[model samples]
Target: MKTDADAAPLPMLYRLYTAGAQIASPILDRMARKKLQRAGVSKARLHERAGVASQERPLGKLLWIHAVSVGETLSILDVIKELRQQAPRMTVLLTTTTTTSAELASKRLPEGCIHQFAPLDTPAATKRFLDHWQPDLVTFVESEIWPHQIASVHDAEIPLALINARLSEKSLMSWGKRADLARALFGRFSLVLCQTDPVRDGLRAFVQEPWKVVTSGDLKKSSDPLPVNDLQKARLAQAIAERPFWLASSTHAGEEEAMSAAHKHFVAQHADGLMILLPRHPERGPEIADMLRTEGWRVAMRSKDEAIAPDTQIYLADTLGETGLFYSLSTLVFIGGSFVPVGGHNPYEPAHMGCAILHGPLYANFAQAYADMAEQEASMEVADAAALGQALCALWGDDEVALLQANAKFYIEASRNIRKDVAGHLLALIAP
Candidate 1:
């Protein structure tokens, strides 16, 4: 399987890889089992990870989408819904790597669409899975790649499209070193719709094709703001009773201490101000709780059934799939991963919610999105706790908050056509 481009030579290392998989299958299987230790796989549907199906294949052109996690899954929801509406006969199959993603897909996927755990990336498992599902067209979101699965799909002459495709700076440099391997993998895609020009350039250097690749715009920009429960939102609003609040969402390891200190600084100036801190990984909730408590903050853990009391300084929302609720309650929302070197989580989610988006200096992961926001004056990039605290204090007034939110709304409106645009190109490719 090849595109009509001058692809770099396929690497000799690929054959060695599959051959190695053959010998190390047992060890790999054990690792796969260990992955489920944290309740990521359902006991009833556990076989799905082993390339066994619990549901029979639906008859139609199955447009299979493989997105790795909650972010990727949510980003493509609008695209999938548009495609399903445009071509009613198209049955959608969405697969994710994590149990949280699978649970999310079950709730969010459109009617008639199926959600399943992705099969393990070994030849036997992938073959068993693909042979059963027999997807007509396969799409991968972001940068998830499984060598054997990709090869098997191409071997069966499936049309592959990579939507909102991206590679980090580190990934691009590493792949450049292994040009032969890069070409072997990237060349198999019939189309690669990259998020930015630089990403398109990096892919072009490997596949060496202009025709198969194009800038599709970021799919996330078009997704609906993460959903919030209206009743819960109303209750939270009443309980707080017009208190000034800001959210530091999806905080990672190093940034936790800084954010806690920042919250304390702001609270010193504004007595009733509160900070709702949400960790990126809920599993680290305990560690964050311990750290904040030790630092003398009145921390209330969501997992422990603690609510935002009148005296509660830091409200710790330590659970899955609840970021949307907090996004709805606050206008000044700081996306956390940027504060440290962990790249950044998607600020677009908050931007779409019309947040007065806040970030630290480091935000390479979603750099283009942040740049767009900054250009519109829709967001603020703070350097440290002092800056973040001061900004929060200044923005507590109604007029300033409204102004920032207006800018965010403008940014969202300016960049919304990507889902429809990308869906049109995808439908064209998959059309019979």
Candidate 2:
């Protein structure tokens, strides 16, 4: 069972990368502090970015899992719960790189799991983190390929796995260009559970052993539907009973204007049509509201406790961890981050809640997932505001939305084995 950590000589690129990281540690730490501050890390907790733990590590075999953001974080919560079920004495340490993900982790991470801000990928920071935590196994989510941290964990002889692994077309090409570096990094992993067969094929070329990379299916598809607050769902359902409303969810900066234009088109025929705008970042609620107001739209802010009045054309759901509630409220959902080049948000969230899904064309990150949905006619794609408006108008018809939703349910059921397979592989990796 010897891996790169045991038998392979360090690739020349790997040697240079670790050495460069060592030399750049001081500068990287300072830069990380500035970036963390801007991401809303408090002054007291800033050192967490430098690999300093704010709380004491628990005594026992620890499984360290790193997921870079909210989507990645959510994909693994159920996995953590599964892990705890099999190994009650094993504690899990989850690390993330963003404030929103940290917030989500605080509210949703299962028992026996703790969250921390991940260390910067520099030699000093990774060393500090590894020395303090001393995890028995480590796992990374998606495309988090930090050389220093991976190398540190490997050098410490911790079993490392990359679960729900994927690389965009662009990233795969980039890695292909640097074969040595890719091998050096990918070789260290004891296993790589890819999101799709294509991802496994794309990653296999770089790994020293083909068995290390296997397709386990997309974890997002297998994740539990976004949790809803029943009380809140009931209250909101009562407030907007029988209204024709759609949700523009997890929208980025540039996509909001497109959403606004589409909403305008929807209301032209049905004047009472409502658009629930949920931006990706909750902090930008005020800015989004102001912009919509200037466009002559009546906007009601969720964070402000404003009621969804009859005159309110756009209800701004700018709160955190309530997407499930919003998803439940709408029949047709336009998942944002697609109109722009953010590779789109997870469509699984909306699909699981029985919402007919729509998105723009830039979904390379979730290519297979989107393609599978499109094949089943479970999701629709729009190129811009005009196309979005047309789709919205068409999908609002009861018959049209129901067909898409039925297809979406079919896609979900077909993929039900994904989580079980992923959990089984992870359980094997983390087994003592």
Candidate 3:
């Protein structure tokens, strides 16, 4: 790490960015709260984001990790657990941006670890949070780069790493436009493990030192399948026994309508067919259920305490954090949030569960996971509703479930060592 004012000045654009954030920090707080309110952030917890401590930092060496949201958080819990067991004296401070991520982190973070809402990216807030926590090592999950936060850590000479870093086409163009800014921002990290070749290549092109970038295994591939209660899985299995079923997991606004169209066509061929539709936001359960009901489908919502009757065509697994249970009951799980414009959700959930997976063409969020799946024929990508319907019919027509399931399992196994390898590097960096 650079010392004695050797770090480059924030590039022109980033300097302006930080200045703007600092200048508007007060107004920004109110606007942020409004945004958080719309997203269901807890009112009591709003102080944390303003760089106020809700809980005292534990005594001893601390590792502060930033996982931007639920999908990014999911990939790191297993690693965090392993790190906790490996270093008993070290405490983990996990920070997330969204309410849903905070909720999941509270349950899954290892014992003694603290979960806090990440501070907004203003100079003062970043400094206050850094000074209070005094983390021994800092890690950012995925590509959640905050200019002020990175600057604070770098200036302090903290050991920093970025895991599962990725770059979409839009992200690539944005970074590529300012080489000096990109390199200055990225160079602060002691290590960067990219999830895909394109991301690795993009970083190399953006930065002067290409050595920091590597095409590495995605953390999601190593995550445990979404947790499922055994009793719950068994009950669901019995309820949907001997029925040809497909699932549309983690769907978005536009994609559900498309999947419903496909389901209507699919049910015509298989009378007892059922489709499990789990929207990306479970709060929209009523809206989604009502939308399908008006289309002449018998829909049962999980949140509403509706059970799947014999004639129920769609079982809406509309609750949070039980996706794994439904995965066990599904023969064909269409990884959703892709059929629409919103970049797709994590594909690793279905892959980790050994479910036969399908998705739309827009699944850029988990590009590496999907790429690996495609390489091994573990999943299929459909073009649109009509194409998705045809693909569903094809899966129904053939006895390829065994083959698809095996391939999905194989893809996950291929990357099982990623977490250990990443943890090894992290431990060495912050070794006592």
In model 1, which runs have C-alpha deviations exceeding 4 angstroms? Answer: 1-9, 33-44, 398-400
Clashing pairs in 1: none
Q: Choose 2 or 3, whichever is better by lDDT.
A: 2
- Candidate order by lDDT, decreasing, is 2, 1, 3
Q: What is the lDDT of residue 262 in candidate 2?
A: 94
In the range 1-432, model 3's lDDT, one tens digit per residue, is 332244345788998998899999999777767877787767776767877767888899899999988878888998898788888789999999888898898777878799988999998778779989988889998888888888888889887888888778798899878767887888777778888888888777755567767766788878877778999888888888888889988898877899899997788888898998988889999998888999889999899888989999999988977888888777788888787777777777777778888889887787767777888899888988888888887887487877888898888878788888877777777857
Steric overlap count per candidate: 0, 0, 0
Q: Rate the local accuracy (lDDT) of all candidates.
A: 0.83, 0.86, 0.83
Q: How close to the true structure is residue 126 of candidate 3, measured as C-alpha lDDT?
A: 86
RMSD to truth, every model: 2.4, 2.4, 2.4
How many steric overlaps does candidate 3 have? 0
How well does candidate 3 match the true structure in TM-score terms? Answer: 0.93
lDDT of 2 by residue, 10-110 (tens): 57787787788788878888887888788888787788878998878899889899999987988888888778887888889999988889898988888
**Pick by TM-score: 1 or 2, better one:** 1
**Rank by TM-score (best first):** 3, 1, 2
